[model samples]
Target chain A: MLWNLPGIHVPADPLYPGAPPFLTNTFLLTIVGSILIIALMLFVGRNPKQVPGKLQNLVEWVFEQFLNLCEQVAGPERGRKFFPWVLTIFLFVLFANWWEVIPGIETIGFKSTDTALSPACAHVGSQGFLLFGQYSNCITPFFRPPSTDLNFTIALSIVTVVMTQVYGFVVLGFRLQIGRYLVFNQGIMGFIVGLFELLLEAMRLISLSFRLFGNLFAGDVLLVVISFISIGVGAIPFYFLEIFVGFIQAFVFAFLTLLFFTLGTTPHGHEAHEEEHLAETAHAEHERVASALAGAKLEEAHAQ
Target chain B: MAEHEPHNTQNSRGGGSNPYQGALVAFSLVGQVGLMISLGALLGVFAGLFVDSKLHTTPIATIIGLLLGLAAGIYGVFRLISTFRKAG
Candidate 1:
């Protein structure tokens, strides 16, 4: 079944003495995911062909679909610019999440002698084999899904939010982008609103990170519990669900990133123009009402 | 709006109006709004704690931070809603 939740604790024993304990199972899994992606890319790029092989065809199809999605979300110009980053994120996240469904991912690892579970409670039984002196349920998993880790998700979010700001500055210029955070024109009210905008910007990091971390971690736990309850058959449907969820989450993350990029790159003047248009409409409505009232008053006078 | 016209046309061509995509967009917006509010408050609390520690004002700074956080949360929700509306 499941070991103690990975990344909940920094392993006391380092992979090598004098090394930091931060090299966690999730970190290892992230490395694995990266390697897999690199290998796939290398395989696809090793030989060029006028016509494509199955693998190349699959890769090309994915690329085309994702590029189309980016174009839809961010226009052709920005979409082409953002295509690589968004695609990389989507592929990495999707692969990382799918790693969880691999058999024995969090189940198989070296047993540790420093377990929190008591020896008496850790005996093998009809339910399942229990190894003593290991972490939760006496099993130390070697790899866990990287997306389940907050650090991984947070790093991705930082990249996203930081790049968004960078693009904003590149498109709108520094003063205008910074103006988004430090509004000063409308006196105290504008200043207050600016502070809120600033806070909201900061909160994007948490939002992006927590959404990925929460979903993957919860799914991992759910799978473990389900498997523990019913060993094989019952867990199959859940695995399929996780697979679907993994794809959806990856798409959502990429789509949201594209959306943020589009929003960020848009000049503040556009919003101001919309506001002006709204004001103009309101004024026109007022004028129409006033004219109607005036005509009604003139008719009453003429009747008198 | 002129710039976005091509993008809109592309989306229409690609069947972007599918109910599933609409649901996903809605879900993303709602989740983002919720996270922004909670995290804003949490960040404010941390900021307040740091300020209190530095200034020895204790709960006053924390209370002010909490209020500011609430305002920020509400503003964030409005901004997100407007952004999605504009995008859609």
Candidate 2:
């Protein structure tokens, strides 16, 4: 029996009729992902325990890990301030990427009625399933991961970049922050550099969004192609690779966001140099302690 | 424990709270370098195209925009490297 190869849609299909076209499968999945995160947070945070249960312990460990990351990268005060934003971004992105690995997500959907397919190859099932066909893609999957959609990634990137600007204003005040892009007193070279910086800020909106979107979208296509070539046999390793890729992409998004926040909040000129120096020293000290702890744990394990 | 010592120290050197964060930055950095450059050129061309449409200069603005965008992308990559250097 021939397996029906699914069609890849760059723009998400609307989940239902009579609604806005923007209410696509990707949009619904994003909302579902958000609600899941919220519910998990609420369930975990409902009661505080002196000694955490398994669920609470897992959540706390994740929280502490990110908290340490923030403090290490951004300095103590700024890191603490930026922690919530960094954590939220990480969790949201992580879920979105992981959803790609779920079995039926992009695979299970109704046969497309509108997409023009050759009558010779197209076989629509009794229940509207696109069954065993030479056609590559005839089914419109009910769910597509949010990262697979350019819109979702672009929206997230814009929010992150805008928040960086907001943080700049909050930390360095209006004059200093605005001065970053428009420097009159710094001479022609400085002026050009400032312009480049401004252009780079706009370019980040593209870079951040496209990076996540490209990686995940390509992964989806790869899976479909690989599965098509050799059926189930060749796709196993790629699925595992997708899981790893998913996590790394999520981590990169969050880490970059944290870095941008740090850059945004930092004051310019001599103060910038001084603050960086201090943050570096503190970060080094933290690393030393972490290394020492790791060594101790290793030694204890050896002794046992 | 002895075998793991190097791995643990390496994690610390990588500059994350865990090994996952430290090592993955290298992976992310490589991807970032390529993406930054392309995006820079792409943005430049788009802006150039817009200006050309407005002023009817055709490809002249587009060419200049491409050069400037490429340059901006290179500069952006430089900043990214320095930032990571400072970070790690």
**Best-matching candidate per DockQ:** 1
Q: How much is B22 displaced in model 2, in angstroms?
A: 1.2
DockQ of candidate model 1: 0.43
Against the reference, the lDDT scores of all candidates come to 0.76, 0.83
True contacts kept of 2: 0.38
Each candidate's fnat, in order?
Answer: 0.44, 0.38
- In model 2, which runs have C-alpha deviations exceeding 4 angstroms? A117-130, A134-137, A270-304, B1-16, B45-64
lDDT of 2 by residue, B1-88 (tens): 4556554342344333666667776777787788879888988899999999999999999999999889888987887776657656
Interface RMSD of each: 2.9, 3.8
lDDT of 2: 0.83
For model 1, give the RMSD to the true fold. 7.4
